[model samples]
Target: MSRKNRHEEHEEHADESWLLPYSDLMTLLLALFIVLYAASSVNISKLEELSKAFDNAFSSGISILDKSALIEAEDEQNKSQKQRHEEIGIRTQQEKLMAQEQEDLEKLKKELDQYIDKNGLVTQLETQLNQSQLMITIRDNALFASGSADVKPTAQKLAVAIGLMLQKYPDYEVLVSGHTDDHPISTSEFANNWELSSQRALNFMEVLLQNQAFDPKKFSFIGYGEYRPVDTNDTEAGRAKNRRVEVSILRKYTDSSATNTVLSAISDEANSAPSTTTSN
Candidate 1:
């Protein structure tokens, strides 16, 4: 009877094998939840520490979480480096383009100066290269008679020459502006200096457009009359200087700080230079 009672007691004890598997499943679930929380937090250092802890606890060499985090960090670093390289490349290209443009403008200015010197037109024509534009200034007497809007027949060759030089740079914008002395005019052809200046600028621009290479859309004409004079209108010589035409090739790319510096230098030079009185 005692042996039978002991056997019954052993049978009454619950099966403990299932408890081991259940506890293992609970542990696995907890690990999964921890992994999810770490990944959502985006704290790489904390994630690496957790991976190391999990690796040591499981006795595994390296955890999948660690490998995945390392790969993600490497990818982010590569993307950042690529973006920086692209930005540098773009800036380099822009600098190259700006340098080339400067060279072309300088060359053109040199050619124009040569032409002026060769033709003995230094007294009638002058060229100035500034940060904003390349300006070609011509005395009114070179292109027209006194108070006349018509371009002289002989001066048409000069216009043709300038147009030929400009053909090398088709992309630049050109402005033809006319200025006049303060003397009033009431001729049958022109009511005032404004009308005469406008007609003169239009006629000069028309001659320039005769070249087939020139795009008329890129050219503009304006007349300042006596409003925007380079010299005084009080004296005959100064008035002669004021009565002029200007052809300006506008710059496509300009640095504002550099332009200000150049302008200041030019003003200082003009103030120091000797003033020579020349008549038209």
Candidate 2:
């Protein structure tokens, strides 16, 4: 009876040994499910970190998760570099266009200057190239009679000449502005300096439009009246300077320093060149 009891206890011990292996198998399956859930939810960067941890712990080689993260990072970097290169190319093209525009304006200025010299109109007309615009200033007396807005019949020829010269650059925006001396005036045709100045600018602009080549949409006109004077109204000479009409060719791109450099170069060339006029 004692021997049989010992045998029964041994059998029970051996059966429990099988249970230990079964419990271990269940634990391993639970761990695999948890790993699968984490992988599905984690981002690539986090997955790479997890892969590194697994590699260290198990002495495994490079994981597929790490390789995928590295490839994505490299693709992002390449896309960023491509975007930078495209922006640089666009900037370079814009710069080239601006340079071409500046060259065209400079050529136009030279042609107009030569015409002014040839006609001996320097006393009545002046041209200035600046950062904002290329301005052509004409004495009001050259265009209109005293207190009158009508352009003088002889002076219409000058307007025609200027209009023809402007035809070369049809794309530029043109502004015609009229200014007057501070001397107050009330007449049958004009109630004040404002009306007089406005009519003068309008009439002058009309003459400029006679050349069918100009785009009327690109032209604008304004009257400054007695205000916006360039010279003091105290003296006759100053008043003469103050009463003027300005035709401004507006610039598409304005840079003061770059314009100054261009102006300096133009001035140097003018000073060195012979004082001779050539017909356009």
Candidate 3:
């Protein structure tokens, strides 16, 4: 009775024991599926971060293909971050290039001012470096006699000086704009002040370009007449201020580019340059 009982017990135990290992395997598979579902629902950035954490934790000196998928996921995230950094770097470089161009223009403006003061050209021509362009304003009386479009000999000399100064800098567009006082012009050569002012500006531009040293590609002329006056036409003083010609040097970069795109436009010359002028 004892022998039969022991043998039966051993056979039952052998068959039933196999269920323990099978149940353990099934439980592990269920847990793995649950983990996969959770990971799939996570945001990409956080998923990448979590994968990296797993890589550091499970790095063993064995050939396990288990880490390959996680490593690939982390690598993709790293690549995306690196691309963003590179884009930012390119933008920064472009901004720096624009800033340097602005600085160079400011330096040129200061030189022009010194030339104006040294040659006693004040009351005749004044300089201004603004956001869009560098402007050199010349009073009409200095360039032409009243009711005349012909540029005076003194004005020709002034143009030559300014033209020579411009040659020192890189090629840039030069706009020679003519403006005039509100007074009506009834002259033999012109019908209205507009025609007279425009002719004067064109004549001045011609004088400046005569040297051949000036690049024709960089020059343009426009006449605003009395319409674009700097001052009111109601008074003699206002008319005097309004009757002028302006030579504007167009900058490659605009004000918005420097102020918004670049780090800052803190030009030493711009800061120190005179903000306003007065005629005696």
Candidate 4:
């Protein structure tokens, strides 16, 4: 009975150690929840206090959470706006350039048409304004004598007048191409019409280059003798139409660097040797 009573007394006196830490933990958690609730209520004074406390505890200079991210976002927005403005400016300039080019092309076409109409040279010359270029066509008989590479004196005057007109617009490239009928020739001067046609084109180009306003470097000539004829050789009229000289004027705004490279290459090839005709 005595041992039983002592055991009961010892059990009664045992410390409640678990309750103390658990109560402390509960109080801390309650305080944390109450602080969080106060912060969520948008109390400006409490938020500032919390921020100051954290800054002091962490030894931080700035209080904002994502300063770098906000700055980067603003910078990207500014950059995008600047790019959009630049794109709009470029589009406006391009539109103005296109309009000016169209006006220039129309003026050139009208001048050629008037000249042809006044001189009664409709059968000899014609002009075209297509998407890529402006073309002026001159019949072979009008520019050259039969079986000859030499340009006639009257043809020289016509070419000079055309050159004068071209002088007004010096930015365009001049391409003088020669075409011939299907009749084969084996003369001492020319082995075939290809040689003759090439020479004639060169001769025309030389006359055009004589003008002080025209740039000799931009002039090029090619011969397509009997190969790229406009009409068949079966009929006289068709043959007449087939034998001709053509001058194509390229626009100024069409990839200036790339066009100049191609023109340079063509000039080198034409200077090296006469090109052969391939059937179209």
- Give Cα-based local distance difference scores for all models: 0.83, 0.81, 0.75, 0.82
Tens-digit lDDT track for model 2 on 1-280? 9999999989887745688889999999999999999878858898899988988756666567877899999999999999999999988987897787789888888989999899888999999987778899999888888888889997899999999888999988787888888887766677777667767888999999999999999887767677678988889998899888989887776675653443353245324422321110
Candidates sorted on TM-score, descending? 4, 2, 1, 3
RMSD from true fold, candidate 4: 14.9
Q: State every prediction's TM-score relative to the real structure.
A: 0.64, 0.66, 0.60, 0.68
Top of the candidates by TM-score: 4
Give, for candidate 1, the lowest lDDT window spanning 10 residues: 271-280
Error of 1 at 232 (Å): 1.1
* Candidate 3 lDDT over residue span 1-280, tens digit each: 9999999999887756789999999999999999999977859898898887787677743235656977888899999999999999987887886687688778888888899889887777788877777889999889888778889898888889888888776477777877787666565577666567668878999998987877887777766667666778889889899989988787775675643321222132113422222121
Ranking by lDDT: 1, 4, 2, 3
Local accuracy of candidate 1 as per-residue lDDT tens digits, 71-131: 9999999999999999999989888877888899999999999999999999999999887
Model 4 lDDT-worst window of ten: 271-280
lDDT of 1 at 70: 90
Instruction: Name the candidate that leads on lDDT.
Output: 1
- The residue ranges of model 1 lying beyond 4 angstroms of the native Cα positions read 1-85, 256-280
What is the model-wide C-alpha lDDT for candidate 3?
Answer: 0.75
Q: Extract clashing residue pairs from model 2.
A: none
User: How far off is residue 19 in model 1, in Å?
Assistant: 39
User: For model 4, what is the C-alpha lDDT against the true structure?
Assistant: 0.82
